[model samples]
Target: MKSLNLYIFLLLATLLGTSCENDGDRVVLSGFQEAELKATATNVVLSNENSGKLVFSLMWDAGQLQNTYSERYGISATALTTTLQFSTQNTFSEVKEVVETSSSKSYTGKALNSLALSLGLETGKAATIFIRLKSSIAANTQSLFSNVIELTVTPYEEIAFLYMPGDLSGGWDKYTTKVCSRAGNGEYEGFVEAAQWNNFKFTTEMSSTSGITYGSSPTDLYALDDSKDQWNIWFEEGGYFLIKANTNAMKWSKTAITGFYVTGEFNGWNPTVNAMTYDSAKKLWTVTCNITTTLYGIQILANGDWAMAYGDDNKNGELTLGGANIVINEPGTYTITMDLSNPEKYTYTIK
Candidate 1:
């Protein structure tokens, strides 16, 4: 009996010493819990609705993990049939190094399932994380912790120009409005066009869910042409256009174009061409082109001065600069009139 008791005491001491040696030199810490993670939405688009860029950050009892990984924590987002999985590597030690070392793995990509991070006994190993919403996971539901995250994206621009006439009938009577991504993932009901490029002679109307109506510019889609070969083949459903090139330089008007003196003289014709007019109700621009040649083409110009002000003669509302800016020294009701006498002219009020 004395010998048996002595043996048991020696065994216990040996086991305790072994455990201390293994755990003393090395300490492992779990990365972070879902509640500590944060995600934010940067941007989104309607045409490309389901996909967007998201940025997330992690914070936890980093302790030794930060120094173990050679690279900044690596992040990778893996896609499953219907979801995304985030995977992480805790700490990777170099095989050659005697001193403890660590390597890190991160998550990136279009996150669509479950995400797992290596932790606990899995230290210095890879971990596949299961991402589940707090509402779905009973472990996370009652706990005051967040296991999964979601956020809605906002767009860079609230409103964008989608349509300008690309191909038109000889009379300029029928046209298609070009399409682009809308702001806030909203719908674009309708658009207007100018008689010609560079001339701001078009009208536009748009309304939000609030039932408030707003005027827009006759955006120019002149740059879209086969000559440059930048855009895809003209697609009606996709809102693309094929444009012409090398047309006579003419002065554009709200309803007409003129001053083709050089081309007119070369072709033994008059210098002035008829103005082009866009019938909003008809959604068409009609013009008479007497001097004929295939050299005529349209270039898409940038939207300038169109989005700023509107016909806010009374400064009671936000002044969108459809016309010019006014210097109002005194505050009161000011009558600003646009030059309607000539459809080709621009007019507005300052006060």
Candidate 2:
């Protein structure tokens, strides 16, 4: 009877030990839980003088590092690494990473202007900057993004001229064939004559052997090849054209002009009286007439109508609607030339 009692007591003790072991295992596993991460920032500003020295601060939850690693990998957060990433795109397509190792809840860093420039953000323009925290444990990683911040950067201007080189244009000369003007928006615009089936492209410098050249593509502009297979854009018929391009956007467009005329003080302000001749090679309109040394108004009429007329506001070069009429101080067999290819700075010379 005593042997039976001892056997039963041993069985009960074994069961209790197993239950205790299970309870301890549960406690260990439940200690780790998913971590929550967040970040905050103040205003951000960028400028030319301060671009290289730009700095910003970010504050985050203190226990995120520990909780994230513990919950995800059953490891201590001290073994994980952290980085601050700056991106122009909220999707984080392109990112610049800066290592951060602050045990405190906040971090500060500089070199923001350099990062902004690398992302192609123009100076003197405001852009939305996206920032985030990248945490990693071994090869496993995760990102926590902060609220987007808007900043304006003062960009340095790089003087560049666009040249047209082709078989029919500029005689393929790189140095003397510069025809495009760079606008404030970084676009290039000018006039060029393309012969039927003639090929041409734009270049950054006056060199056929060196410098950046933009070539034609079916969908968008492409960088030309250095050695061979350089593509040239051609037109169906030979004519004078107005070309505009935004190289950064890889976009280009062209317009063909047929004729131009002038009518105002020279012809009693009649739009149909005097017609100017178009010099296709020079891409200008020219006319010669006798006039008095009177302060008479003159206007450039296109296709002989009031539908389109251009006048100068300051009488310097810029053209605007309802602009002041041109004044001819001296009257002779004056030769007048009008260049309308550049409408923003349309000019006329009287000699």
Q: Which candidate leads the pack in lDDT? A: 2
Model 1: residue 70 alpha-carbon error in angstroms: 49
Q: Taking the tens digit of each residue's C-alpha lDDT, what string does model 1 give over 1-351? A: 323443443354455446656766322212223333333322222222322322333322112111122142221111001112222221222110110111121222211100110111121232233222111112222322234433222222233322233332122222233232233122222222333222111111121111111122124333222121123222223211122111111011121221111112223322233333434454333333333332321111112122322333443333223432233444333333222211122233222
* lDDT for predicted candidate 1 compared with the true structure: 0.25
Candidate 1 is scored at a TM of 0.19
Q: By summed lDDT, which 10 consecutive residues of candidate 2 come out lowest?
A: 25-34
lDDT (Cα atoms) of all candidates against the true structure: 0.25, 0.55
TM-score of each: 0.19, 0.49
lDDT per residue, candidate 2, 1-351, as tens digits? 333443343354455446657665221212112223344434445543443342554554324422212333333434445556667778889765555556323321223443454456776666766766665433332333444444333444333356667765446673443444333344666656667777777766566654355667654333333122346766778876666766545567776755556666656777766678877657777888676544666777655556557678786866554677777676667777877565345678888
* Model 2 lDDT at residue 44: 49
